[model samples]
Target chain A: MLLNKIIREKINSKLMLTFTILSCLLVVLIFFGLYYKSSPLFTNNSIKDLLFSSEWFPLKGKFGLLPFISSTIWVTLISVIIAIPFSLLTAIYLTEYADKRFVRMINPLIDILAGLPSVIFGIWGVIMIVPFIKNHIAPALGISSGGYCLLAGGIVLAVMILPVIIHVVSEVFRAIPQDLKNASLSLGATQWQTIKYVVIRKSMPGIIAAIVLGLSRAFGETLAVLMVVGNVVKMPHSVFDPAYPLPALIANNYGEMLSIPLYDSALMFSALILFVIVLIFNVISRIILVRIERSLGIG
Target chain B: MDKRKIEESIFKILMRVATLSIVISLAVILISIIYKAIPVMNWGMISQTPQGGFYLGENGGVLNAILGSLYLATGATILALMLSFPIVFYINIYAKKGSWFVHTVRLCFDILWGIPSIVYGAFGFSIMILLGMRTSLFAGIIVIALVILPIIVRALDEVVRMIPQGLLDASYSLGATKTQTSVKIVTRQALPGLITAILIAFGRGIGDAAAVLFTTGYTDNVPTSLFDSAATLPLAIFFQLGSPVEAVQNRAFASALILTIIILSISILARYFSGKYNKFKV
Candidate 1:
């Protein structure tokens, strides 16, 4: 027994030591991966120009990533504009108005929606969604034919993100303690009034977190937007115009990186810029998520 | 009372409309994909390689991509599990206090989780490209493992941490070896959760397209080694959709359905594993 006890203690110590090493190794590797891959494009002078320059012409040796940035922002903005309403309305209905059984049914449906891969969604968009917009939605708005356009991409993105936002917001609403609901009801508040005045107020941080998460995801979304968004590098005149985002630019254009020094560097530079944007967005979302956890005492 | 009841009914109706539409849309999308896919699905699509366009339902299969996905994903899944469990165990067990080491590692995983898959793709691309490997099967395997590591770590961390400390103490007090306690007592307790973690990582790895799109250079031909170019199922769908042939379109739809079914099955199995494990503990 004494020998076994000593053996157990030794094993525990070894396990602890091993785990520590693994964590450090992975973190180091990730940073190394980023810095190592991005070194070619990160020289001090060109870094500034790549980030701040107004125009992006890789073929002419001008490689600013601003167009991809603005294009990403534009499509993301349009998507949030459409998705925010649908998600909020859906959240309110699910939490404040729907019956318990109905809520159960809808929640899993949303989970399944969330699990749907972006590639399948892209296929759906290219085949079914693009044509629908070209023949019906676009012309109805008096726009030129653009089955593949910013509007189509944004809408598909909105649909893809709706479940995530709705899931987060509804969870927030559900997390509000029953006592708060009872108190609101006892004060003679209507269901809507209770939800608005009490429930939403209490869950404000979570709602913000949900919004931030949605924005972060919308900004970072790739295949869905890449497949639908017409790969036009120019600025959009309307939602119907084609757009190319940073993700698409890197994904599609990077492979064609031979025989041109400027073009190859341009792809790497855009990748670096994308890294920065995603990092900032993730930080903001983390802040909001932390606040939600603190406010709800759930962290 | 009557007026209040009427107002309640109106609100209920509004809720019904919004909730029902969302549900209906989800169903419609699933049914639509299945409807498109089932008719075109055949054994040959699984066994054969693409000869021409599979859109009009007349071409070859997704043999290389299918085999590549399974082989690479299986490799990645195994690698991720080997890397994950030890880290998760160390973090949860040894780093209970707000120690600098533990805190930094935890933050690293958090940041890694949100880092875009494209960035991983970029990193993997440079390394692979430099190594004279552009779009090889090994590239897909490594990047997918890295991409899903954060999620697997998080899930496994939670699972391992939940193994009660008493069990550890009890085993030790009874004179068991440390390895015995860890491998036999704690890990046994964490079986269901570990399964959940693995399933989650496997699901993410198999479904990835964008991260691997450039790295796993498109290859219609079957790969004979980790160095060979390969297409995954998601790549198959994307390439097929863009092809001009009607046969390619049909194959794309069928492949999409197959992908959906694969994802759905993984999710279901994951849920069951998690739930059953938790239930068993209770």
Candidate 2:
């Protein structure tokens, strides 16, 4: 009996140790894989040329990533801009002004929205938004092109990102001490005043973190944006122009990457850039959130 | 004071508009999907595999894709559970609360959670190339398991963390080993949330197209082994929509409708279970 018990204990400890280390080990392996695969880009190319050049022809031996870099930045910025106001107001309403019954009904809806597949959004974007833009909005705006452009991509991304920003911001709003709002209200502040002076001030850090996280999501979104964004490898002059972002560039070209000299390396380089940017955004937001939790004495 | 009242009312209107827009957008999405998908969604399209030139408006079905998605998601979710439950159990039972190691591990997971699915695919593609592996069900499973691992761990961690510390103390006072306490008390307390987490991860894994685009390497056949290239509902929709033919495009919507129904049912089931658990607790 004692020998069996000892063996059981040994097995327990071994299992625990192995599982705990597996997470860290997998992360390290992924990082090493990306780093090792991306190393070839540095051999024949200067980092400056990769970042600044607009020409990206593998046949002609020019590997400028300026077009994709600009596309990614522009699309991300536009999507975030479109998403923030609606998300902020919705969050504020749900947490502060809405009735409890209403909040209860909407909360699950938001969760459902968050969990819906991106492909659904992609299909909607292609069938609904693209044609609507091409037939109505584009002509009205005097832009002569198919609607498969940066604008469609941004709008779809905004819809996909809305739930994420709203959820996080609302959570932050919920975390604010109720007594602070009560004090503001009892001091003769209006409802909006209480929100502006008490709730927003306390949760500003968390809200910023939420927006940054949303931006990271928008930056790395693929497939939906891929379906909408016309994969023309050029710098778009306007939101209506077809342009290729980094993720789309990688997804579109990586299948045939080995065919062109340095093609695979350049695509790997793009992936590395995307990975690093997302990491930086996520880390920054996490640090800020940790600080917020520490200050508030919540975890 | 009067000015402030007017501003408050205006702000209220803005907030209502913002919230209503969300409702409206969701309504629009559903309405459009149903209207477009109804015509093409039929019995045969869902039951048979493709024959010749399926992308050219030919008569074929998404049976391979539906079955492949089921196999891929089930495999990945099981793999993720095997990896995540142990880690969660360790952090809760063996390690001290708020330890540096726990903090670092949580931080790493938060970072992983934010990393895009495409990035996971790209990273997985590189590793696959290094191992001289082709795109197959196995590659999809590994990459997708990695992608959903953080979600499962973080969700289950939150659930387990909510189990009162006193429960652990109580179990210890009764002379239970750490393993026993964790396995019995912690698992019991967190079972419902664990189900919810798995549902969420399954939905995520099954719906995701980017992570498996290159890794899974789509095929029209049901995957017979881990090495077989598998078609998925999302990729089927993607390829069908890419076609210039109208009928093929309609089939894309049909495929999407099927996927949406599957995801919606899973979520509803998740909500029902969690709600039931909450009532039982109270």
- Model 2 alpha-carbon drift over 4 Å, by segment: A1-11, B280-282
lDDT (10s digit) by residue, model 1, range A1-299: 77767776767777767755665575456556655655666563376677667577666767766667777888888888888877887898988776789777777678778778888778778767789999998888887767888887888788788897998898788778899999999998787668768988887877877776777677777888899998987866788888888888887776577666656656665666666666676666666665665577763
lDDT of 2: 0.89
- B124-215: candidate 2 lDDT, tens digit per residue: 89888889999999999988998999999999999888888888899989977778888888888998898899999999999998889979
Which regions of candidate 1 deviate over 4 angstroms? A1-48, A52-54, A95-100, B1-15, B52-58, B97-104, B130-134, B163-169, B175-180
**Which model scores highest in lDDT?**
2
TM-scores of the models, in the given order? Answer: 0.89, 0.97
Enumerate the candidates' DockQ scores in order. Answer: 0.46, 0.74
TM-score, chain A only, candidate 2, equals 0.95
Q: What is the TM-score of chain A alone in each candidate?
A: 0.88, 0.95
TM-score of the candidate numbered 2?
0.97
